[model samples]
Target: MVAWSVCAKRIALGGSRNWILLLVVFVVYTTWRETFPDAHSLKTITFMAKMKPQGANRPSQSIGHPKIVQDGYQKAILLSYMRGGTTFVGSTFERNKDIFYVFEPEWSLIFQTMNEYQPLQNVDGTFQDPVWIHDADETVERLIQNYLYCNISGIDVTSLRQRFMLEARYTKPLYDCVRMKRNKMANCVKNFTNVCTSKKFRFLKTVRLRVHAIEKLLTNDPSLRIIHMIRDPRGIAVSRQGWQEFYQAKMTFTFGRVCAEMLRDIESVEKLPPEVAKRVLPVLYEEVAENPESMVEHLYKFVQMPYTGYVREYVKNVTHAAKDNTVGFSTQRANSAKTAYSWRAKISWKLSSEIDAICERVYKKVGYLRAKSEQVLRNYNISLRDPHISGSYVDKFRQFRIPP
Candidate 1:
């Protein structure tokens, strides 16, 4: 039988007691606790900047639909947060600007789009005095180039890692800037409410990408379309593991680690306040590929893009790619109508029986499946509750608090 998707989280309140709740992610806890384990994230960040999109969200200019495309732009960054927001709805973009569908390269999108840029803010929540957020595109470009060389180039030396060591190194202006910012951290926090000072914050938050940063970008660039793509948990689990191998890194992608990262996205969606959720259009991998026309129609309206005949044709080819992606996987692809139960097939029957027994009821209640039997669900502590990955998804996750 196919199992359902349950986005498990890693960031618990204190990070231990309820470890069972996060067992799926905790598996990789020792190997990979935080998504990106670097200490650079220690830099303090303000919340306002976190409210916008990391990369520029202006509409595409090259998609042939001139009206929908924003004028005078080049590249744009996309936040494919977790499972659901990953759908390629943005792939059908018929704009002049090129749309690169980024699949969680961490904060690379923010750095790539207008690197070493600066931010400009105006009065009244509307941006006026504007500039690129990255301070120096060239410097960042170099960093990206060498980093990629060390990473994807498959070149010699592992010695190249030494070059990247200098990428984030402190140098006169950059070093002073980092230290200065560190010193005045509290003052910056106080200056956050002021719009003029607020724009400078783009740099602060970009250094650490957050959903709020995406939300802030949305506010500035109202025309950008946001599509949340979702895939089956099993497929994600398998795909991540595979990517880890392809890269051949010491700390490979663990099912638990990816699950922890995915939890953030799921929690973000379920926790969306009334307004933001409306702006976000959720499209499942299965739903979109299975019913392309209908899904595309809704996506166009959501992003305010025009559904031209050209757009429809492009969507067909993309869907074809999606269908082909499911092949060769050890587990069933997430797009099918069936539950992703095949994932359990890989585990020893003993473990599978326990997991299903423990998760079955809660799984079904969250729309993953219908209960095997009324009594079966109760036995698993599964009621009409939503088993989400985010702390936000749980009103009181410690207790079963489903919204009434």
Candidate 2:
């Protein structure tokens, strides 16, 4: 009787264990499906991103132990030469759910309060870390995601730089550890690079990344893949309106000026040793806008990654898809910076000289022109009337300027 009772208990326990195992498997399967949809499922990638506002915060959630994963990615690094669209793209990448992205070494410049033993609030509102890093899981992730918040408002870059400098001085060993790991990430064919470089993180200790120390990152990260996105300046300058118009921002320089600078930078590259070209690929923005699908596929190929048909489909659908359900309609998505090919219809002889000139210059470069009176498709260079030349709209520019 005693033996039978013991056997019965053992059998029941085994059944319970089996049930628990089944439950664990079900939960994992559900999570995998929820976290990564059927499409675009792969490892993290380094793609060009624009400077946009960060998403609102959600309740704290972590599928993996964020601390361990954070430590892993913190070692990864990203490096890009200026005009590589690092300012906007890097920030976007840093805000990703699956990756850890640190801004340029100049990050110390943007996060001054981080210098204190505790998180202190900077004047324009940034918590600089005196330590190389505060909390592996939380602080670093928050800083990357909130980079844009510092930009949306005025920011103070000076204090952040001080903290960065201080960390370099006192925590030199920790900084070196960070660099060594990042180098490992950068050299690998994957987007994980340890040392990263960019023109600026926007200069407020609260928001900006720094220009100096880029060489240090490069030296530390030798196998960095240089990805350059060369967009025609004509279209880029009017981008004061950006992806959103209500948040219009007149750039520090004109489109032509910036574009000229970009071209000059590329020209100097041709001066580099021939072997250098193998490390870089210049992508024309016009070509990207016209046929983003194939162009991005070409980029993936250049990077030695397989550009699956799904990637082609996704890039194209996103790039060329109508700005909204109102693709033909202009008044949508609040800011309304989307001027399709029909924007010329809104322009008349009465158009202001500045506005008309801006339009003509952009149209010329964007391949849009009123041919004697009709617009038609044109090439990337030698801007002409292009009926299909519907470039991004500069709506807020109209509001900020004297009515033309």
Candidate 3:
């Protein structure tokens, strides 16, 4: 009877141990499935691998362990205004295979709020005024956080699609990582974060957000650098005015106001302390447009990227196209060098003078000529028609005029 009781007790204990093991496995699987779900399923990974660049034959960098990952990635933001040759500068980063480039992620949120009347809601679900939504100091902090994490949960899908398209060229590794099934869902999260965080260089390009919007990012993130691209106010004014008819309904301010914003943007940079100012590199559009190769080389050095033959060759092709001026939209084409001065021919002397007057502070600060040569003005037939600046409003030059 003693032997029989000992054997029965052993059997009961063994059965309970097996049940407990099975329960643990079940819980782990369920939690993982809930976390990642179907977006990164095995089937999707298989399809994406096949769709990856033709003849490419390498597995993605492992998401193996967080401790194993290196921590010296450089982050950069292209702070710019409309028609400031931002695209040309941004294209350089895009061509480099090493950089994980995010083009205007802020556009989907910032511009949408300004252009549309619909209230924007924060993560907390409270509806916010369109203009005031992103003005809060916390808004840009949240933007930088989301951008670094490679997460797009807060952005509107439609705005992202319309403004910036993520091609297969950059997203191959992201797709490839979903193939790892050992740790399943944990791998999915870690792999995505690892892939993004492991990159040596990460760039975010934005023409919409002001320097003040991202001031905190400079103070907090030691790796973060700001490339503030400024064009002559005359050029920016001309570009915005060119789009006047198309954006008839959206005009909320006069031409002087447009120039005021340029000064305000420069002031935002000036307000930064010397330590913060050291991180900001101001690029003049004229310098870049005139000599893209040299400017790009200098910029590459500033960002700590080695200037390679690949980048040089790309610059040659781009500048050559700009010199040739083959396309209608110079900004879109290879000939941005020529486009930089194209504004000089388009705007009248009076309008240019108005922009220079309103943007005098910025011009002096950036070392730009306040006005074009009188000879050049004569050649371009500088006459002011006093056309409506936007939506039946005339230029505010008269209102803000200073005594000569």
Candidate 4:
């Protein structure tokens, strides 16, 4: 007790070095409790010794619900890179009435940052250089956490007023309410919170955040799950070529970064503790496209959501369009399976080979087969996907180091 009193006094006169003393005190208390199992008085003394007096600044707690008590609600993030077919995947959740879906909540922050920084752009107006933002990871995490917790006020009011940010079906009420009288906005936010909290599932799809950025959320919130979507670099490159917003002088640098990010994300997931890691589901765009129904079923099972006939029909309708929409950002597909590899038909041999070489490590890690010749590149019959290779293969490649 005397020793604990001394430690407590030292803690009260806190400095950075006091953390070491706190650690020592914790170890001693834990060891003492284990040795003397019935030392109830010691436990109380230790607890009291650690308590701070009034007016002391408390340590900030992690945002989100405790892992043990999420109250049967599920929170999910469809974490992917841009042009990675997230829109198609996110549509599944969006169409579901039970889910309160938020589409790219981080866009507001990214938009604001881009406007402030005035990042370098290509002749075509594409962001050629990366934008550096202060505390980007922290800000993104906070935005996501606020949305998951339904703390609308924590999000910027400017973001809330953006029509694009509120495009999710569940957010339509708030969108309409925001455009009305200023006084009514507060009431709308409250009503939105009520609706958000009442849902069985809360989902957000973000292309801006990497897998590591959300590791804290997974560690702290058992209900939070990650659908880590990755697409073939070739396909992504081809897709970007069609999109004006993503046009560049050449795609080599951009595509290289995409693969690198994917590799890093895979490695990040591998390093997570087993319990936390299990909450992340690594999905391939090709696999999902090839077998939409089956993949959707698996995805639904992974998240513990029921696979209803309605969802099945929705998937069929979306994936089996009569004509493929040529629009850059369109999610509609005439034949989803073919669309997954349509890049083979569109990409030149030179570009394909270049991308193949650039993303070779990524291909091996994620189990994609590289084309050896122009004929093979254009051949739709020969699948680029390794039948044996799937997202579950992440465990097998952890020993390999990412190239510099």
Instruction: List TM-score per model, in order.
Output: 0.39, 0.35, 0.62, 0.74
Q: Candidate 2 residues 1-404, lDDT tens each?
A: 57646655665678987666656665875654442222122222112122221331334333122221111112222333333333332322332323223344434323333322322334343643322332332433344323322221122223222223222222233234323435431122112111121211221111122112222222232232244454333233333333344322443334334444443444444454544434444443444444444555554444343445554445545444455433321122221223222233333332222333444544443343433422322222334334353331212111222121
What's the true lDDT of residue 214 in model 2?
A: 24
- 10 residues in a row with least lDDT, candidate 3: 392-401
Query: What lDDT would candidate 3 get against the real structure?
Result: 0.58
Residue pairs clashing, model 4: none
Reference-based lDDT, each prediction: 0.35, 0.34, 0.58, 0.73
* Candidate 3 C-alpha lDDT tens digits along 62-140: 2222222234777788878776778778878878878877776665455444332333443233544432332433544
Candidate number of the best lDDT: 4
The numbered model that scores best in TM-score is 4
Runs of candidate 1 exceeding 4 Å displacement: 1-88, 94-210, 219-225, 242-253, 269-273, 318-366, 369-404
What's the true lDDT of residue 29 in model 1?
A: 45
Task: Estimate, for each residue in 1-404, the C-alpha lDDT of model 1 and write its tens digit.
Answer: 01112332323454665555556544654333232222122222223335454455543222111223233322223334333323344445422012212222223323224322222221122322122443223223322322212222211111111222122211122223223435442332223223222221011101123344344333333344345444444434434434444322422233344334445555665565555455554434555555766766765555443467776766665544444354322222334333222333333333323334443433332234333543543343443223353432222221221112
The TM-score of candidate 4 is 0.74
Backbone clash numbers for all candidates listed:
44, 36, 2, 0
- By lDDT, highest first, what's the ranking? 4, 3, 1, 2
Indicate the residue-level lDDT of 21 in model 1.
Answer: 55
